[model samples]
Target chain A: MLNELRKIQKKHGYVSEDSIKKLSKKTGIPVSIIYGVTTFYAKLHTKPTGKYIIEICDSPSCYLNGSLDIIKYLERKLDIKSGQTTQDKKFSLFIDSCIGCCDEAPAMLINGKPYTKLTKEKIDKILKKCKS
Target chain B: MQILRKTDQKAYAKAKKLGPKGVVKILKDKGLTGRGGASFPTGLKWEMVLKEKEKEKYIICNADEGEPGTFKDKFILVNNPELVIEGILIAAYTIKATRAYIYLRGEYEYLENKIRNVIKKVKAKTKSKANIELIVGQGAYICGDETAIIASIEGKRGQPRKKPPFPTVHGLYGKPTIINNLETFANVPLAILFDDWDSKLTLFSLSGDVTKPGVYELPVGTNLRKLVELGKPKHKVKAVYFGCFGGCMPYSNINLTNENVCGKDCMLGAHTIIVVDEKHSIVDMATNVAKFYEFESCGKCTPCREGTMRILNILENISLLEARKRDLETLQELAEVVKETSLCGLGQTATQHLLNALKFFRKEFEEKCR
Candidate 1:
């Protein structure tokens, strides 16, 4: 059920109520249960997010490797705080618990593709690619 | 340097020749155990699943290695996925399971394509009867628990069901199921091929403040200091955080064997080590680890959900110098409650690292507290 919602979010940017209702009807699960599942998972977004979602790893290993610095850099560069989508709806940034990339710490996933060993210049280049 | 090569079709054939009971016997003789940190006897688990009379038994390879700092499974998938597929086949054949699923983690989106290709190749080569499928998780750490993983596969919320009807009897859509960790399954083929199973080595995901921080295959019951030495520390190591938030032990207690790391005070849950040098702050590390549990809690029960959040709050207070001395006592007491009352291993062991930090590095917390 969670995977189905994630697929829907992947295609549509967020899980709309109509999709949820349709999913509930198709799967024979209650709408409340669907909502509950969606809300319980961190990756599943209810409302529409931006074109690109930036998930920064903020767990201990990543934190020790200066993931916070990358988050702060992204915030300053993108002019939006963590958990906020851009005013132009181009990017939404948030801190993820851990992406299982501790070896390559200071990692973030831009639209589910990992960017590891991050630097300010690398972040600039990544955002530039997204812009284009 | 390469531990796993091609599918080991010869080993697979030999294992298949040995009937299910014979295979189980070999597994028992080999002393193979679950690499997912529980150290449950693999042979015993397979024997139990094989004995189940259910017609629709299932086998699941738990590739959801989301435990922080553990990526040995990813290494296996990337480099030697065929070995894991073969392991799954052996288990399926032994248990007569008609279906199997590899529950891959969501963070490992990159490895999906490679694993899918390997699965295709292995299926074509072996012509196995079991219908194998890959189920991708949507970012939740609790789903790593076997029951929760089963629930997730059933298209429900990834929360654990209370154990009495364990997965061996009622699992994966209410049929008998067998789930093994990725590394555990990877070891199956090796156990079949090699006779010296007693000396078989296991992979350790080593990282953090080490010169060569990566996966190392070491003998079972290897010492902590020996494993750390493999990584080549960058500085004077003050402590080692063994087994994926398992627990923290000071440098003085470095002489630990794999079998004994989970003593009365700590656990070596997943065999993942994160070295903490002298420069790192213990308070900050504990706070970050607590924050992880708080965020990842499935909220199925109050003790885990509330306890983790409360622990995180107190840790944050301590870090900011706002916590009173009494908060330390409350933190310890809260950890005990969560460990005792939580529904799943996530809650039961969530406070382990925090508790270890408090036990060994109380002065760090004390310095921060008023």
Candidate 2:
């Protein structure tokens, strides 16, 4: 495990990839599987996340609910594309398929939290908060 | 408890002073997310609502915790009404909403009165621009969907529709409406105030394997294995299931902490962990969840309505078959069919457990066949 942790420290600059792999390996999971743990799920991260991880649910539920517009609005405001970190290192905008709150479709996840039934105004408000 | 009965005034005060952006910061720092099934970042959700188009929109709090074996919302209503109120204020302000509604579950009869008292208390004090209303649901789980929920609010049938223009565009009497889950709304204030939802050990309605089954608060990222080992007393845990019957998962797949199996639904889904101890059969868990889907599936979609029933019957009959690779292929095929054609997300994701169980625990399913 220690060896794997050191390997992760050497592999990635943020959120140890090796530790996750070691954990997965210990749990009978593959390294790629561990990546799925982070990649597939928005909450789990493979890298040391930026200050803010702006997540808009792009799942069928959220997308069909208007997350695409929300994403566009965010991209325009942040001047960064989805799955990319902001220049200021303050915000990391990305798309999450689902955070499980479909009842509040058109949802988002900033960091690990979820916001449902989104709008441009609400997105701006959240970005403004992240700016603070 | 009396405090729970009153409107969540403290949340408003915090939002008032915190401002929209500041609230987001606090929420981000506190790691707070909406507790209503989908564990999206509450601060971010508020941010989205705040940064959006300038239209008279609506905010609805979803208190219809009807997924079976889930009741953490009751505690939020009992212990943190003010928090919920504060979340609403922030959400309303962010979304530029003129009004906010708390669509509480009808089964929670006490929630209605308690919420009403809180609204009255807030009304007595300084009122915000947004009007707050406390409404009751007919205890229909389908009503939990945003579209169905909107229809219900408009005095229509509670059935979800095909999304496209989405709710942010057309919702609630043709106006943009944002509906959040009960726990999601409760997390709003905190997310607006704190960045991490794991500031404390949130409550979980754990039952099955161990001893204690009532609602208990466990530290975020706490290993479920440890909880199983020490939650109540070490019992024979055959398999652990996360989420409820609606979202229940099989054991082996149950690992806790950041490991995925550890926490049931810390942020995104139902927090009910049903432990099918060694004594019970995984087939039984599958049966219960399958039965749940069969019953709860909104008939709007044929694949879900029929596929779910078919999956249940197949699994039940698999025990009678020779338990060959063909049965496995059949199970996988049924799962795929259900996954492809479900109208709502619940029906679609319902097969995650069954698929995983059949794939990993093939021996167990085969054992049942004998």
**lDDT (10s digit) by residue, model 1, range A9-92:** 899988889999999999899999998888767788888899999999886667767887899999999999998999999999
- Model 2 earns a TM-score of 0.64
Q: Report the lDDT tens digits of candidate 1 across residue range B211-315.
A: 677888777667778888888988998887764458788865444555467663666667788888888889988988888899889998999999999999999
Write model 2 residue lDDT over A1-132, tens digit each, in one string. Answer: 222332343345344666775677676766664453233222334666467766565533344345667888888988889778777688877664334444345676664456656888887777777777
Q: What RMSD does each model have against the real structure? A: 1.7, 22.9
Error of 2 at A18 (Å): 68
What lDDT is reached at residue B118 by model 2?
74
Q: After TM-score superposition, what is the CA distance of residue A66 in candidate 2 from its true location, in Å?
A: 44
Question: Candidate 2 lDDT (Cα, whole model)?
Answer: 0.61
- Comparing to the true complex, what docking class would candidate 1 get? medium
User: What i-RMS does every model get?
Assistant: 1.4, 20.2
On lDDT, the leading prediction is 1
Weakest lDDT window of 10 consecutive positions for candidate 1 chain B: B1-10
Which is the leading candidate under TM-score?
1
